[model samples]
Target: MDMSETSQPTIDEVDLLLANARLRDELEPYRDESIDTSTGRMNLRTENEYLASMLAWERAPALPIASWFTPVLELPPPDSLDDDSLNELLSATIEKLYSQKVVLRFTDHLSNRELYKIIYRDILPCCEKKVEIPGKFLEWRCFEDTDTWLRYYADAVERRRYQEEHDVRMPPSERPKYRRDLPH
Candidate 1:
């Protein structure tokens, strides 16, 4: 009923305008004849979101996993920690890593010390692209051997196929040594 209310842009309209401006700014440095940003093949919102995510990922810094946290995540020597202390610290550390979007997979086969050592010696020191986008996570597989994966996770048919493909006999399947209920 009021001219002021009709003249003013809604919140969603303002947000859309802001998003379009951001999308244009993000597209500026990446301009090329070959880059197809046309909305004919995709929805404008989806395309804009995709381009924004691409720019975010491209601009993300590569840093050590430990440095991702404030003050850095420092762990005590594996030898100095007793079994109870090690287990508690390991669980807390796993939670902390998950909070930073770092997930440890197929770690049940490893003992607490082994997993902790791997996290400390390998994962903490490793440099990874730190993409701080929502729903983005880095899955670190603790096991490298396909045999371990087959034994622990694969079904009978999958295991049989793997054995046939590799031309090697696989050991009988067994359950994981310790399965922790952690966020995926």
Candidate 2:
């Protein structure tokens, strides 16, 4: 039997299940809290925490999902500033990308052409810089030529992986399971 030929549920189906599970878990907390009269009017911090936890739970798995949903761009920082300033700009850009879940696909062994594509096609046009790297790697005049961009990208990737693992490792009871095929 050719396993490759076997039909499998689409991402939409899995997404539906995930959505249901999220709702179920979110509601469960509210239901449990409703029993306690003293739990009325949740504080801002508490509310924020609850929302954060719920969101984390929901988005933990299937990270880099933004790559699928959002358009990719490659734009670099402005060249008018000195190397130090450029590094700062690059750091800020990396942070913004991480927060926004933008995937920066680059490897340590990236060629100048590859770097240019990432800069011009993905990072530059969308971001402020629009600067291109003339060398194989970003030269670090201050500390070391440690491709800070790649570091940030790796961090984002690792964060997603950790979240995905956490989601999978969560106890079945703690994680809500909903059957999509069932009538609502």
Candidate 3:
């Protein structure tokens, strides 16, 4: 009797299931108030992807921030600075940040002083962010409520026109760009 054509045994998914369970179990201890509170549960796969990223970050070696910003940077106080001097400093500082892959946006409306202050204070202080993976960047969101900018920063003509064009009863929900992609 020829047994060469006997059907091959099917591969069991038991290992895969067990592996996923193990990954989840290992990740369970990491779940806390700080485990990506901004991350949304779009679906099982999305949740799993986030968990996997968390695991990878936890496992990856942390690189000194100097690896990103060399020689370090020191900025004088944003106070008592003229527009020309502040602009020069801001340009250099922004370029340094760009070199580190940290981009700042939505700052066109900010004054030279305000922008420099944010860089000198909030931004420079945050330069110590741990680098686990390469190519990841930190985008400093200066504006929490864009609506406030539109309402307060906009000229009277623009605000009136906007009010005329859009519903004034209720403003549209403006979620942060980072949290927008996250599943609610």
- TM per candidate: 0.75, 0.24, 0.51
Assess each prediction's global lDDT (C-alpha) against the native: 0.86, 0.40, 0.62
Question: Which pairs, if any, clash in model 3?
Answer: none
Please tell me which predicted candidate would have the highest TM-score against the true structure: 1
Candidate 1 local lDDT, 1-184, one digit each (tens): 8777777877876787688778878777877786555656765567677777777776789999999999899999898999999999999999999999999988888888999999988999999999978898999999878888887878999988988888988977999888777778
- Assess the local accuracy of residue 138 in candidate 1 as a C-alpha lDDT between 0 and 100: 93
Q: Among all windows of ten consecutive residues in candidate 1, which has the lowest summed lDDT?
A: 35-44
Better-scoring candidate (lDDT), 1 or 3: 1
Candidate 3 lDDT tens digits, 79-106: 7777899988877777777677677766
lDDT of 2: 0.40
> What are the per-residue Cα lDDT tens digits for candidate 2 across 1-184?
8877878856765665565556546655545543322325875444444444544444444423223224643334344546565555555554455444443432333433433334434443332321222222222111122333323333656545655866533221121122112111
lDDT of 3: 0.62
Which residue runs of candidate 3 sit more than 4 Å off their true CA positions?
Answer: 1-28, 33-49, 56-68, 127-131, 144-147, 152-184
